[model samples]
Target: MARKTLRIAMNGVTGRMGYRQHLVRSLLAIREEGGLDLGGGDVLWPEPVLVGRREHALKEIADRHGLTEVSTDLDAVLADDSIDIYFDAQVTAAREQALKSAIAAGKDIYTEKPTATGLGAAVELAQAARAAGIKHGVVQDKIFLPGLLKLKRLIDGGFFGQILSVRGEFGYWVFEGDWQEAQRPSWNYREQDGGGITVDMFPHWEYVLHELFGRVRTVQAHVTTHIPRRWDEKGKAYEATADDAAYGIFELDGGVVAQINSSWATRVNRDELVEFHVDGTEGSAVAGLRNCRIQHRATTPKPVWNPDLPATESFRDQWQEVPDNADFANGFRAQWELFLRHVALDEPYHWDLAAGARGVQLAELGLKAAAEGRRLDVPELAL
Candidate 1:
């Protein structure tokens, strides 16, 4: 059977996530023309017509990838009847507007996280997409992660029986303010431009919790902007108005408690271990980016209560690296394939606009809690 051709118009195809989508498109083009397949069926291949600002950059990207269908005008691309989907990786503040326009144009949509800058906007966006009868999805990439996948399998298989709680450790030490140029994007430190760790990373943990444990019922958070100022790439200094780190404690629907510590001030110890250590009645699992290891009661080391003993030598053999059997794409690429399957084949895909709204909900609640110093209930936000 000839593969169905999907004409996609991408917004923010020149940004970081945009470049990622472009690379994926280039790979898809290779597969469409029949080249690389680290092997599964034809899930990854799609015809991506790139779109972005700046004719020179767009032309360079398209020419480099051998793609001719490139555009600078987003509305023009949306107006074209040939475009099957509207893809977005633009800044978060522009997401609702972009998706709103695309849905109005009657196109299926895929975009990066937080979907909307606020919960109200996110809810409206979801409603708009549903009313338009167009398929929609956001990039919930962590679920597709190999380590997280293994942890999910264990949780599903009851290896972690009677799951109790979860603790997530995620952060990296950004560059010093005075010594060097800016380490992160300028918008990241400014709250006005859809910046902050609370908005950026909580949505991620929200999906992770929803996927692994259950829906979050409430959130109690303490957010901080440790680095009051930062320098950009050109040594231009700017006041850091957004929180660089956030500590959130969540109450899941099933009484499962989870804590997430997100920061930009911690040093990277192990290739930046974005990990979750889940403790349950029967076992405990630690899932990092590269590996997922578990320790059951049967495998846990016996401790003689020596306070002087070094931490590294205490339980050396309790953890075992998970075996990798599935041929998986990076979290983003995996969601990209899933969204394509959802749109092209009408296959069941879970990460819809409602899920995206839930992410926004968590983020908003976390921020509210941080600002007001109170626990915020979030049952109304659950999907």
Candidate 2:
């Protein structure tokens, strides 16, 4: 078997998500598995070149993983013709310039979404990638989640005759760094640092709703900073300037109405950190990160509202679980595999920079709608 290598310049792996999901779970996993089988005796391998501002952190990662390439100079890395791809998982404020630099260097581009801080910049990145004639992709990892995969199966199988509505609850309390160390980075709570629940989550919602049900036509939202003060990485107190919560209503193309409440301030009492309850003409389903349960219209229970009577039925047990018919990989890794195939074999790939731009547009519009206290139409976005 002949081996082929694609040297990749990876930025921002020091961040939690970038390190855990992309570097460890995805790329390294591929390398450990002896690369992806590209058929015809050619095996595609990914060689990661760790790139970051922090030398000590990057060196630590390289030493820990036995990776050979490490660089702080992005321009120097870009100038290398051996580097096949440039991947960015950096802070939103810095992503635009990095992506443009990668594009100019003629590298195939892939990155975490909200590709830029604003819609216009996102559109520009998409245009640049297109003009460069290089393969490009965005990480829309939620679509590959097992629960949502089952939901997609249901929809495709026509189990849901017509999806009427969707309601979702997603959140868990993040311990303020004062009492206990915050699980998430403190920068997530500062607006000036390009952080907020609306900016962070609405993009996920845009694709989740669009890919699962229909195109989101309009958005109405109430976004607020539920936590006004929190401690940072250094344990110093700072005024939290970003929204920690957002309540959103989206009208989809097929008259499907969806309402979602996203928060970091609320404590959880649900089965999962995030769950979406979908209602349809013939059936209904509730899907979380790993589990999905469904109740057909015929099996749905009927209960009379009587405050005086104790409930006899267990509503939770009424639905049937959706079995995992196929083995599933980490959502991030699964997307990575597809992207590698797309690049190596010119496979049909749809989730590109354009999709990412739409996500950014939705988040931007969501924030605007919240500020204006109005329902705003989501016009068709074009490059």
Candidate 3:
């Protein structure tokens, strides 16, 4: 019946994703709700110890949020015996060492992906966490998405019989930052900063594919920097050294082919910024972030290729929207809550650092496949 407060040393609160999703939406939201329910009158509360480079920004956020604990010194924060968890949403380059430090400090590790800039570093970090005997998790927020959840339901229920192929499109135009301000951080365009569509997104694809459908057996990709030049935040022109777009073909288990296109240079033409169309023998589904529509084989419309004339069929009307049967919470918060439960009670959490390493491995191979211009086997990672 006692309330337990978990002190989370959150690194990277100054950044957009770390600020919006992790800090404001997930952690603070959980705190405002009087903590996560641990059942039987027990509650698990989270107190964030904001950690970052900028003291002014950290102080501003803390003052704005009525938080007291703020520290720029990560080592000092980690050295504190009270800090129960270390959550990293920092830039990829900084993540590996920070996670290693956290592991050394014996704090529960939760982090944003790809866990590290490279597969070797990620696996080493994972191994360190495992050796330290600490709880660990990676942010795989897509799995908890309403649309993807529904798609998973369909898969589990055998709605998609003889699952064949998956087509995924994810992107939106990020302004080149010449005339207009870019939506994303400027570091996203620099290869030295660990910024690339393949590195940033392939881990996400790996988790999604591995969790919902199957493990990625093979990867073939074409990655390129569509926008060669871009202006930075200070309106200074710079070469966009990182890849902006990637076209990938992942061979999943059971011979399911998944082709996904991820780009920051492309304009949005689809219903959502991201969508996946899965076709099976029994049915087909088109899923966005929040909505999923399905077309059964029974109701499959037969149409002839009539490019010579105006199309008569309303092809979009054929599929029915999958109703939201349950109220869905914010994906990030849902995962965070599960992570809390996992930390508190040692619940079954599959999205560990090793899984994160696998994601990094997949992405690394994806980039390699792109460079080689050949399909590369995604070997089973052991860490």
Candidate 4:
């Protein structure tokens, strides 16, 4: 008998992330001319069954994509027995509600990161998914980046033997919403809405650090709002309450320490490098969005204070461009590939809601530590 095609329904169809990350990139890639190369063999490809969103807006999107299956009703989509997966990319506060409803409807689930605004809610969602016997996953895109994949390879190969410390630099200045058009969404600068770098990005770093080093044991952090006020896309000014920058120190279980600096207030330099510098006894490696570099102590340089001396060679020369095998190899797309494989072939993939919950837990701990002016012992996010 021929296997059934996985009928996937995108819940937040008109949202930027839903359209850009999944629909525009992932689904488009599966088409013959989209460069996906999925037609050469007996490889199975799941088709997007439908997209659900607000009526008028979704109509425009559906027309643009030439998709006939579209609906404005969430319940109608979830209730459809033909749907095999429900993918959610709604705002943070609404994600739990939508996901809970999807799980109740007995659909397998996949969603964007920072699963919920709070740790308890995230955990509950995870538990609910488990109890419902549905496959569940959270998008952890960083791990699939070819640069990070190279870093993982180096780590597993013991290239950086006896690791000592890790440093992460993440940032790029977004427009303050004043004269220029606001670079990011308005919801990103408000507390009432599910906005804040602490929630949005820390979970990303949490997974990266945990994957590279080990489980984080504790955190001491400081968070700040660099730009106090900003204008919206409509030129209306609004006060920014959310912390735009977060600086934290993480204590890994094996005594390895990691320092992370995440912000939206820095100038764009070095190709928006969200790079990690890992220092170890034997050698060191640096991984960024586009490249990975490694250096060993064997050819390590000696310090000299000569002002006229040229800059010494280090990990820069070892850098290489990450290969892109599929359209999903960028952003959340790669994570999508892994999830699809996991669903179709029962392949092992690491990004899960449990790990995503931990990212939220880490951020929560960091925020608490900042508020109370004390170090916080990180709690394990259970499966």
Candidate 5:
């Protein structure tokens, strides 16, 4: 059986997430694995053409990855009739315009989250894609994480009976960039560049809580610019205007409450950089990026409250590690495969632009709730 080739125009392949996750780990990996088997003696092959402003960087990436196509001309690539999908992993502020152009050109779209810097722009993009009758998707990669998948399995298996509350602690101390270079991009510290913990992380939490538990109804948040100053890529001091940390309490449907703390100023004290503890009536589970530990009510230990005495019991030992009963693919790669199959086979994909718009709305409202010092209701997007 002959394999059908799907041409993909990938913009922002020069960036970190775009280069490492989307290009190398996902698309290229798919190609290396002899493309996706669509079954019934048919296969779908992905041929990605790197599109960016830097020809040198694009060429370098193409050469390094054994890719044959590299084009700096986005407009020309969009105009080409052969490209089936146009993917955008560009910066938040530039995403809307590029996506609009792609939609206008009658191309299916898949993009990284936030979708756009503002909710209005994100919704408008969603509406445009819908009006154009194009298949569109947003990267909600966290749902594909191994640990989260385990948590979902537990929830689905009725292990977590009568879900109550969720506590998420996500953060790590990013270097100040004075003595050491910052791990993240310097643009992440600038508000004008669409940088902030609320914008960056709330979208993630929004989908995570909504998909895992229920849609978020109300949000109360506190955002702070913990690190007022930071060094840039050039080792020059710059004022960090964006909020470095955000504390949020979300009220989900079904009376489930979720509290999430996201920060770049805090040090890691948890098992992973990000971890969520979900407590239910029957059991409790703590999930990080790759591992999950559960404590059933029957196995839960009882301890007398005594603050003065030295703690004797090993609290961490009470929980049992959840076994990896299933093979776990890379989170981003798994989502990429799903999206590819969706585009190729016309599979139902719920994580569309409108869903992404909801994520942006949550972030927008979270920032508002933080500024106003009050709980803000998350109204459903009309799209």
Candidate 6:
């Protein structure tokens, strides 16, 4: 029983998503679990090389995680024949060029979503990967969420007969850094730096809707910059050029209507930062990040409309909570494991670069719909 070590060049390891989700939670967790078991006495070991511009931050991360490999030179790392994968979680504007370099070096690629800021750039990346004949994947972590997994289980078990519609509420108030320091990066509010609510979140909605219900056929979006100005990390004020809020209506393939509201300006009222409510003929379910509650049609309570009186019924108590029947791993880590197996074992992976391009297409179309003030049809992206 021999263990196969796969070297991964993890660029942008100093960034928020890169450092937290990919490095600490996913790769490090995988390492802590003694790598991935490939069955039949075979295992895959992931050797991560921290790659970023800040040598001090990279070294700190490497030392914290007990990883010996750390590098600031991406070209040198990519040039190495032993590096099997190149993972990028850098800012949106920097992703395309890095991916192109990785592809040129003939490395298997995995990256954070949006793939690129624009559809054309995303398509080019996908086509280049295809031309290079290399394995590529994007992070579609929502589908791996415990709540979404339970919802998927319900759909698979036919709990929802004729799903009618889906409503998604996602967002939380982000401080403006005037009195309270802004929680998000300043670049997130600047369009010149590839920042917009539509670009950031529509890609996530696209996959969630497509995977759970059906493909999104059309999109009508109203995107706006709720806050015209914001303070930066250095306590400097700047004009917010990007849209901070996006209200979208998506028409699905199976005659299902989906609506999602994404805004950093809105306050949270739900159990989690994101929540989805799906209504169907047989049953209706509301799922958050890790919890799902369902109300069957037979057990649904009927209420009379009375605007003059205070509500007396505890409506929330009627829905039954879905229990966690199985242990759930971190969503990001789960996807990483799948991608690793796909690379090592040549396993079938549906979330390839082409799929990532589709996500980018959705975001592009969503922005177009917002600008034109009309519904735009989503066309399939040819790989």
lDDT for model 2, please: 0.94
lDDT of 3 by residue, 1-383 (tens): 87999999999999999999999999999999989999999999999999999999999999999999899999999999999999999999899899999999999999999899988899899888888999999999999999999999999999989999999999999999998999998888899998988999999999999998899999999999999999998999999999999999999999999999999988898899999999999999999899999999999989999789998878898889999999999999999999999999888998999999998998899989988899999989777
Worst 10 residues of 5 by lDDT: 89-98
TM-score per prediction, in order, is 0.92, 0.99, 0.99, 0.91, 0.99, 0.99
| lDDT score for candidate 1 against the true structure | 0.82
The 10 consecutive residues of candidate 1 with the worst lDDT sum are 35-44
TM-score of 2: 0.99
lDDT of each: 0.82, 0.94, 0.94, 0.80, 0.93, 0.94
Model 6 scores a C-alpha lDDT of: 0.94
- Clashes in model 2: which pairs? none
Q: Stretches of candidate 5 above 4 Å error?
A: none
- The local distance difference test score of model 5 is 0.93
Candidate 4 per-residue C-alpha lDDT over 130-231 given as tens digits, one digit per residue, 9 for 90 to 100: 899888889887877777877787888887779999999999989987767777888898988989999988898888888878989999999999999988
Q: Per-residue CA lDDT of candidate 6, range 134-244, in tens?
A: 999999999999999999999999999999999999999999999998889999999999998899999999999999999999999999999999999999999999999
How far is each candidate from the true structure, as Cα RMSD in Å?
2.7, 0.8, 0.7, 3.0, 0.8, 0.8
The residue ranges of model 6 lying beyond 4 angstroms of the native Cα positions read none
lDDT of 5 at 247: 97
Give the local distance difference test score of model 4.
0.80
Candidate 4 vs candidate 6: the lDDT winner is: 6
For 172-225, candidate 2 gives per-residue lDDT tens digits of 999889989999998889999888888888889999998999899999999998
